[model samples]
Target: MLRYEMQGGIWVYPGKGGWHFITLPTDVAARIKAAMAGLARPWGSLGVTAVIGKTKWTTSLFPDKTTGSLLLPVKASVRQSERLKAGDAPIVTIEIAL
Candidate 1:
């Protein structure tokens, strides 16, 4: 298993859905990709454990074409519990099995 701890600003995807996401830094994303080189799941997504503030949950990291990085969706419950909103920079910890 590999763990990555990073800080990023939350952003809402535009359009009808408007889901909130935290983008991993390019370097961190690259490192994760390398770590999971032979074990990536479908659509380049990886199952992970995400931690934000006092909230933690299981989610998947999806690859973003535009940024060439991975994005972790922020659930509403986590947002509420962590007092986070779109555009707020929060520290996140993610764990994944290699």
Candidate 2:
């Protein structure tokens, strides 16, 4: 089996749409557009805009090697309360499996 660190939360996006969680990576971004695109619900296509994150990014790892997890809900997803919050975006996060 493959081992993963969970690292932190991730944000799956669909262009102008809100961000969702396809399947957060461990210590890397989706690797490529196809990474998440392939696993998307329908499969064979992810016709959004772009995804720029992985594993709960933060200022600590910006520019060079950021945390790399772009998981966020552009609009309503933020107002879900407790689960999410609206503000200046999120970055820098860590998580591990149980």
Candidate 3:
């Protein structure tokens, strides 16, 4: 398992499919990529456990081709529970099981 803490701002994609996501820092993304090399699941995603504030959930990080990094989707429930909003920088703890 790989564990790390990071701070990222929530961003919303434009248009009708607006979705909130947090982009992992390049360094962290690189580390995760290297650690998960040859072990990536379908669609270049990695299963992860994420904790923000007191709320924790299981999800997957997907590679963002446009940004060349990994993006973690924050569910509506999580955003509401964590009191997070777009442009808010929240500290998150993530664990990836290898």
| Best model per TM-score | 1
**Model 1, residue 32: displacement in angstroms?**
0.4
Roughly what TM-score does model 3 have, to 2 decimal places?
Answer: 0.93
Q: Quote the RMSD, in angstroms, for model 3.
A: 1.1
User: Candidate 1 lDDT (Cα, whole model)?
Assistant: 0.91
> Between candidates 2 and 3, which one is better according to lDDT?
3
Per-candidate TM-score against the hidden true structure? 0.93, 0.23, 0.93
Per residue, candidate 3 scores C-alpha lDDT tens digits across 41-94 of 899998889999999999999999998899999999999998999999999998
Model 2, residue 42: distance off in Å is 4.0
Q: Select the stronger candidate by lDDT from 1 and 2.
A: 1
The sequence of per-residue lDDT tens digits that candidate 2 reaches over residues 36-87 is 4433433223223322233232111111123344332223423243244333
Candidate 2 global TM-score: 0.23
> What value of lDDT does candidate 2 attain over all alpha carbons?
0.32
The sequence of per-residue lDDT tens digits that candidate 1 reaches over residues 10-78 is: 999897887999999999999988887877688988888999988989999999999999999998999
Q: Give lDDT for model 3.
A: 0.91
Task: Tell me the whole-model lDDT of each prediction, alpha carbons only.
Answer: 0.91, 0.32, 0.91
Native-to-model Cα distance after best TM-score fit, residue 95 in candidate 1, in Å: 0.9
User: Looking at candidate 2, what is the lDDT of residue 55?
Assistant: 20
